[model samples]
Structures are given as structure tokens and as C-alpha cells.
Target: MNLIDKYITEVGKHLPRRNRADIEAEIRSTLEDMLEERKQSPSDDAAVIELLKEYGAPRKVAESYVGPRYLIGPRMYPLFEMVIRIVAAVLFGVMLLVFGLGLIGANLSGPEFLKTLGNSALSLLNGLIVAFGNIVLVFAILERVLPAKDFEKELEDWDPKELASEPEPDSEAIGGPGEQIVGTFFLILVLIVLNVYPEWLGVGFFDEGKWVIIAPLLSEAFFSYMPWINILIVLQIGFGIYLLRQGAWNMASRIANILLELASIALMVVMLLGPSLVDMTPEKLAGTPLADVADFFSKGANLLPWLVLGVVIIISTIEAAQGVYRLFKSSPRSPYPVIK
Candidate 1:
């Protein structure tokens, strides 16, 4: 009867576009079965009405088919969690490095000393909140933008064999939106901060109830590399977007990533082995509370750049290795022609 068709239409209107067709078909089939079981003709709209009533109203039926929504849906959740852990670890590691350096050649016991510690903790808390907000914002956008078809599979069609390949996804679906979004967000932020407010990367402490700043650690030696650094970072940003659009890594993109990592390693090596990148000149600290620690700042703080570069070099080498391995692993046989 037209009543059954109308009822299914109404239900379909309420369901997600991806699931609407299948659900509407299922509901229609069930209603038809009920009509047959009750020996009711399609012409008898009253009997069909009774069947739909028992099935529940369209809105209620739609609600039953769906559950709660998520800001970062189930499929991408593992990736989101992983990025959070990495970000937290990096932030804490940086805080520890800065705190240790600031403590160099200074009296560790005083009211101002405690204030310094409190300020560092508050700064760390603020950093975590900002990072979390950025992550959530990107993930929420991804959750709404990604297609629903990719989120889940039909439960009835699941196979035990899926466990055999649980660690790997389809070659085309590798390195999904989560990785791209998080990486690009942070990298862009780094570029902005370095270019716009590089002074934020300094040490500060209270000196006789007035705030004092040590010379910012970045030196002319480091800024000189900005052109090359800009090229690499901008290329990296573009490469990440390409991978997001491609939905997976291909041989060309894999090669591109490898080259980029190699370039990063080379830059870190040059910065590490070349002229000093950190300069905490004593002149700037002449009248500050931290004046006595000038030797510690100029010498000890200078070592931090080397430590950072070394760590970056190691990470880039590993990333380059992995990119090489995957590139060959997924490469296809070269095409050849033979003549009879």
C-alpha cells in the first residue's frame, strides 16, 4: 500500500544518508512480511497502519538505529589517542630540558626560586591546554567531514579472517586524515611561532619582584638557515596535504617523504656541526636577576641546541629508514615487453 511506502520514506528522511537506503529497504521488507503473516491485503490501509504503529514512529525507529555521535569517531580514535600521547611526551621532555637548563649555576633555594618553578608548571599547563584544544578542533572537523561509509562495516558480514590482517589496512587507505591533520596543525603552528614570536622561546624568572628575560636562545646562526628551513617546512606541509588527498602513500609520495627526511637530517647535521645556533649573551643579562648565571646561560644553554639537533637527526634517520622500507615493500614490478 502507498501507506507502507510513505512510512518508509519518512523513516529514510530521518536516517543518515549513507545508511538510509539499506534501512528503508529493511523496514519495508519487514512490514511486507507482517502484512503477509496477518493475511492482510495491500489495499487495506488500516491493517498496514496497525503494523507501522507496532513498528514505532519513524523518528523513534530512526533513533533506535543510531547511537551517540562522536567528535572523533570510532575509526580514527586510536590514531587520535596515539597523537595525544606523542604530543604529551614531547611537551614534558621539552619542559624538563628547559627546567634543567634554567637551574644551571643558580641558587636553588629562595622564594623567587619557587616562583620560577611555579611559573614553569603554569606554563606547561597552558601549553597542554592549547595543544589539546588544537587537536580536538582538527579531529572534530575530520569527524564531520569524512564519509560515513568508511566508518563501519555491517556486523552480519564480519569475518574471523579479518583478524589475520588487523594490523594493516588497505594499501589505499593507509595514513588516513588523522595523521595528516595533526602533523600539519603543529607544523604550521611551529612556522607561525618561529616567524612571528620567536621570543617566546626564552627563559624567564622573577628578579627582585620584576620579571627578567635571558637572551632568547636562537642566534643569528639559526635564523640564517631560515630560507632553507622555510622551504623544507613548507614542502613538508604541502606533502602532508598531498598524502591526505591521496588517502595513502604511493611510490612517488614515499620517495618524496624519504627525500624530505633526508633533507631534514642534513639540516640538523649542519646546524649541529656548524656555528653555534644558541646565543645567550651576557650583556643582555647585565642588570637582570639571572646575571650571575651568564656563564651557565652562554655555555650550558648553548649545548641544548646540539642536543635538540641530535635528537631530531636520529628521529629523521629512523623516519627515512621506514619510508625506504615501505617504498620498496609496496613497489610493483617494472613493465617489460618481449618479442617472439
Candidate 2:
């Protein structure tokens, strides 16, 4: 066969059947026309052969038409595309909730509950908005790397096995170290707002200083160390910042959970032991550093607050454990890789 014929046949193998013959004919005609222009004489087989060689083999030419070009191929990963979509929807929904609450808090006026409800709703809406924005940012980046035609093909052939069987992806799969940092930063933020916020943890009779349940005379001393609970708060905030800066949310979260868990267990122990410990009395303080304050308060009432604190600690621990378990044990499809 002639060089031109061979070239056409090779390229045609890669094209769809419907377009194969048409594309082959077009290429053949174009090459012949070029040869004719170069025809200084009636028969110039050598020139035609040289032209076909310079043009390239048919298969190489056909590659240009076979698929949409991408800096990153969609086939490079099938599951990641779906993961991005799901995360995007969830993030959008959360951002809407936060924004709605913020608007309500700004405009509404009412009793404590009504005011609080408005404020909280506004916070939730604002959070949702932030979440949505992050999701969009991630997806926008992925779009540039993906092949256009593969989008539909990916959807049509969605398969779980396809994802798991994908070659073990490196850290770059998520968006490199920088994107992982950003993602971890956002993850910690969501955790702090949802799990570690003080207003949510600071509740109950002791928290509000319910005088009827205890007594006003002993209230301040009874709960003076309550602010020490803020130690846990400080640690958690630090953890959030660490996760943001270092991209270690999974580890930081686990440590934070353990801290709260230990604190909770300590609280329960204190409650069991507080009543049995020595009483607070003026005479007991007479020679002590607190002597000046002895005339002010009784020991039992002072002890009462410790018991209350112990209760808070226990409750906080259980909550922290549950949260930690859920965070660490999410499904395989989770965007965040479970390190363990």
C-alpha cells in the first residue's frame, strides 16, 4: 500500500466508527492535494512518501481527536470526582444554615431564649456559608485538571470498586500539602465551633450561679475554680490552630478528646471524694493563708460546687469520647484519610 493509505488506516483505528471513514477520507484528500501542489512532474512518489513521513503515522494523528485533553486526566481518578461533588453539596447546605442564623441574630429582639435562639441560628447559618465556600474552592481547582468528556463517562459508570482499585494515591491526590493544610484548617474550625465552644459546655445550676439550689454566700468561692475549666478550652483552641498550621487535625482531635476524657474521669473521682475531704472553717483558716476569708463562708457549701464541677467533667468526657470515635471512625469514602 502507499504511504498515504497506510497512514489513513492507522489513524482510523482510533476513531469512532461513524467518523472513522470520513476522517480517513479527509486526511487522504488533504495529503493528495499537498502532493499535487508539489508535483513538479507527473509522478513524484518519493515526494509523497516524504510528505507522509513528515506528517506522522495515522495513530499519532488520531490521538488528538480521541479524547479531551487535560493537564490532569479524569481517569487519573474516578472516585475523587464523586467525593468532591458530595462534599460540595454538604458544605453549601451548612453555609446556608450559618448565614440564616447570623441574619436572625442581627435583627431579632425577644426574651433570653428567643434572643439566644436567634443568635444561635445566625451562627449556624454563618458556619454553613463558610463551609460552602471552602467546598467550592476545592472543586474549582479540580475542574482545571479534569477532562471534559470524562465527566459524563464518570457519572454513567460510577462504581465503588473502580475507586478502591485506583493506584494508591500520594499526598498530592487531595491537593498537595498546601490544600491539605487548608482542608485541615477548615476541619478544625468546624470541630471547634461545633464541639468545643464554651457557651455550649457552660450550663447547669452552678454555671448560672443558681442561688436557690445552693446559697449566694458560698457561690463565688464554690465556683471560683470553675474558670479553670477554661484550661480545656485553651488547649482545644490551641489544637485548632495547630491543625490549621500543621495539617494534623486527626491527631490533634484525638489528643483533645483524650484530654477532655481524662478531665471527665477526674471530675467523677473528685465528686466521690469532695464530701469526704476536710471542711472549710474560719478556725481552720485562722493560721492559714485564707484566714481573712474564714469568717465569710462554710466548708460544706464550698465543697458543693466541686461536686457540681465533677458532674460537668463527667458529662464532658462522655461527649468527647463519642465525638472522637465518630471523627476517627468515619466511612472509607471520607475525604479525610483515616491514618490508622
Candidate 3:
């Protein structure tokens, strides 16, 4: 095709399907009319180049015809990006865990190991592509179907009173919105992995020239608490998104954080005090190298639950203290500036 035809074709590619032909025809006619007024020959390549340059790049021309086109608009773009990142991170973690298990079971050597790594890389790439594609598709549809006014209304619904920060003699920022976002993202991932794909938590062993899959390390007791755990995770994720949107923590969010922490502490207590939380049964360990360490596993298993419980208690206490401190710091009589 000639310069004019090629330029029109490029622009047409970006136009909506229904109006592409009409828009392309109009653009072509306009360009031809402009060239005629300039007394430039249509067959002259230099003239066409100069005219096309003045008309702008094909994308710019297409955008002009389309008028503010976006698969996902600016208002929703940040949330879209955040969701994509969270999904990608979760998929990466799942793939990494699977690859590690495969390596353990394959007993691969030299070239075999390299091949496994190559396969893993390809798998991760494909998985990410599918994940990101789905997320983008969902957001794109929402962009078109969800009314802009509704989103505006949602943004306007926030209460300024929620952001009242407490005063302290030597107050410091507890955690930024970024940190909360990252934390909640990983928390969501953990919840999904633990509940939806518990099998991925298992170890793999090569036995008798064949690969064997072990049961998950976590016991059935862990699964029993998943419903409640999932609720806590969802609440935490909502709170994190709120923080991200608001760009700062408020009195309400701090209280919610403490309550979530308390819920977590309560859940951890139930899990730790419940029946053996390890599924290291002899049958499960049989024919694996771990069988040799059965006694060690037993000993560690007995102490592991208590150790986890203690850690959770310590963290929860600290978080609760911080929340209380922040509440007191944001007192009306305090001289420190409130977040609102």
C-alpha cells in the first residue's frame, strides 16, 4: 500500500469496529482535501510524509476520532493495577512452590534440572499471561458497563471523621498505606493458597524410581478454621484498600486493625490448642528420606504449635498497643495535627 493507504489502515486499527470504515473514509477524504489545498501531488511520497506528519501519528488521529478511549479509565486504573499485581504475585508464589516440589520429587541431574527450570519459567509466563488477561478483561468490562457517576458517588461517600489521628508526645507514623497494601495482598494470597490449593503445601519425594506426593503439612484442623480465617483476610483486604484510597490511616481503620488482630489471635489460639496440627503420620512419611527424621519431626511438631502461638500473641499485643496509643494520641485536647 502507499503512504496514505498505510496511514489510514493504521488509524483504522485503533478505531471501534462499527465506525472504523466510516472514520477511515472521513480521515482519508480530509487528508486528500488538505493535500489538494496545498497543491501537493497524491503520488509524491515526500508530500504524503509531510502531510501525514502534520496530521499526527496514526494513534493520535484514531484517538481523536474515538474521543478519550480507554480500556480502563484513570479513576479505576490504580485499582486495576493493584489487583493485577496481587494476582501475579499469588501466581508466582504458587508456581514457585510447585517448582520446588517438582525438583524435590524429580531427582533431576545436570541437564534434567536445567530443563525443569526452563519448563518452570515457561509455565510461570503462561500462567501470568492468563491471570493478567483475565484481570484486564474484567476491569475493561467494568470500565464500560459501570457508570462513571456511580464511582464518583462511591468516592464521595468517605467520612472525614474516620481519619482522625491520635496525638502523642513522640508520635510516629504506624504504617503507611503502601505497607498495608503489601501486607493485605500477601495475606489474601496466603488465604487462597491455604484454602483453595492446600495440596500445593505438600512435599514431594522420589521413591522406588517413582515420584511420590506427600500429604500437606497442615492438618485437617487447619482446614476447619479456614472459613473464619478467610473472613478475617477479606476484612483485612477491604481495610487495606480503604487505606490505599484514603492515602492515610484513620481512627476507624486503627480500631478495625486491632479487632482484626484480636480475631487472628483468637483463631491462632484455637489452632494451636486444637488437635495435632501436623499431618506427619508414619504412613505419609514412609519410603521418604523424611522417614529417617520421624522422631525429630514428632518432637518439633509438638513444640511448633506453641512456638507459633507465642509469636502470634506477641504480634497481636504489639498491634493492639499501637492502636490504643494512636487512639489516645488523636485526642481532641492534643496539640498534634489530626490526619483529617
Candidate 4:
């Protein structure tokens, strides 16, 4: 076949099966018309090559025929981007927390310290890659499976009357979509690490030229609350996703937030009264040079549980209070007509 024919075939290969033949025929006809206008000999290979070059690469030409192709379309692009940033931030935060814990717990020589840092860095990089891949894959699947018209309908359903009735100058602003997205993403990572990859939460040390890892800092009693925590995480994730799509918080979201916060507080209270939340057993500390330090931790483990429980209660109380205030601030005013 001649260059033009070969070019058309290549373009056709890149096109969707349903429209390939029709698009190929149209492109070929257009090329012929253009060649006729240029007075280029179709039989001349050089002239055909020059003409094809002006037309552009086969892939580009096919793309033009296909129109704008997106793995995640414009409607979902902002949400997709927000999700990616949140996941990345959460991953970074988790890595930093892990590294800090290791630094505090592990006793290492200069070279061993450097090696540990290097390994932590590599692990963080890999985790980020995997997180990004998963996020992209999810969005891509949503893009394909979700009907465009459904999103359009959602857009159409919006009512201007639902806008905040009055501005509260003294009221604290609720978290924006970005903040909620990041918070939700962070919670998800916590759930996954706590449940699936608890070993990653441990400290590592070099012992007699062999690397040794300690048991995870969290105890089995802490894990007993995982199912409850998972439920909270899932709820928060759903709320965050709703805020992301709506691009604002409303009464519904505020109420959901308050409920989740209360649930978290209850769980923390249960944990505090139940059992020790930290595991610094002698066996976990045996091979390490920091046995004395570990013994101190074990002795002080009771205090550690109380400290953690106090922190959780304080944070959850603050969050719940904020949610209530936000709900009150956003409530519909009598002067403004409520949207049905």
C-alpha cells in the first residue's frame, strides 16, 4: 500500500471500533481532496509523505476525530485532583509519623541511622506511587461507568435558594473541600495501616549486622476497636466525598460530622476503660540495644494509654463542638425562603 493508505490504516487502528470504518473513509476522502487541491501526485511517494506530514501523526489525527478524550472528564477533574492531593498529603504525613516513632524508639549507630532513613524514604516513595496509582484507577473506572447525563442532572438540580441565608461573622468557618478531602484520606490510610499493614507501624534497628524490627506500638486491645474505627472512617470518607462533589458544606454534612465525632469519642472512651493500648513487651525489646529504654516504656505503658485516651477525647470534643457550631451557623433563617 502507498503511504496515504498506510497512514489511514494506522489512524483507523487508533479509533473506536464502532466508528473506525466511517472515520477512515472520511479521513481518506479529505486527504484525497487536499492532495487534489495541492496538485500533488497521489502515485508519488515523496509527495504523499509530505502531505501526510502536514496532516500530522496518525495518533493525533485519530484523536482529533475522536474529540476530547479524558480518563476523568471535566466534571470529575476537580474531584480527581483533590483526591490525589489528599492521598499524597496523607501518605506523607503517615511516613513522617512512622519515621518519628522509629527515631524515638530505635537506638542506631551513624551508618545504621542513615540506612534506616534511606529505607524509610524508599518506603515512602513506593507508598506514594501505589496510592497515586490506586486513586487514578478508581477515578478512571468511575469515568467509564458513571453516565455523563446523571452528573448533568445533578448540576441541574442545584437551587440558588439553598445558599446560606445569612453570614455569621463570629462563627468559625467549616473546613473547605480540600481540608475535608485530606482529613478523609488521612483517616483511610490510618484504617488500612492499622488493619492490613500493622507491621509498618513498628520501629526497626540494626543488631549485630542484622536488621531487627520491633512489634507494632499499638496493642491487640487497640485493634479490637478497628471495626468501629473502620466504620467511622468510611462515614467520614462518604461525607468528604459528598462535600467534594457539592463543593460546600450544608446542614446534612454538619450533622453527619457531629455524629461521627461523637461515635469516635465513645470508641475512645471504651478503649480507655478496656485495656492497655500500647505493647512494649520484653520479647519485642530483647534483641535491641535499647532494652533499658524499652523497660522504661513498659513501666510507663499505663501512663501512655491514659495520655492517648486524653488526647483523643480532647480532639473529638473539639471537633464535635465545631460541627455543632457550624450547623447552627448554617441553619436556615426565617427571613429567607427555604428551598424545597
lDDT of each: 0.78, 0.55, 0.78, 0.77
**C-alpha lDDT (0 to 100) for residue 115 of candidate 3:** 79
Winner on TM-score between 1 and 2 is 1
lDDT of 3 by residue, 138-176 (tens): 999999999999989988996777545432223344354
> Per-residue lDDT for 22-85 in model 2, tens only?
8888888888788778763324567866887877766678877776554435444444554554
Q: Which ten residues in a row have the lowest lDDT in candidate 2?
A: 211-220
The RMSD of every model to the true structure, in order and in angstroms, is: 12.1, 16.8, 7.9, 8.5
- The 10 consecutive residues of candidate 3 with the worst lDDT sum are 165-174
Per-model TM-score on C-alpha atoms? 0.51, 0.29, 0.51, 0.54
TM-score of 2: 0.29
Error of 2 at 165 (Å): 27
Off by over 4 Å in 2: 1-134, 141-223, 239-260, 267-340
lDDT, residue 40, candidate 2: 32
Residue 32 local lDDT, model 3: 97
Highest TM-score among the candidates is held by which one? 4
Which residue runs does candidate 4 get wrong by more than 4 Å?
A: 34-40, 53-56, 165-340
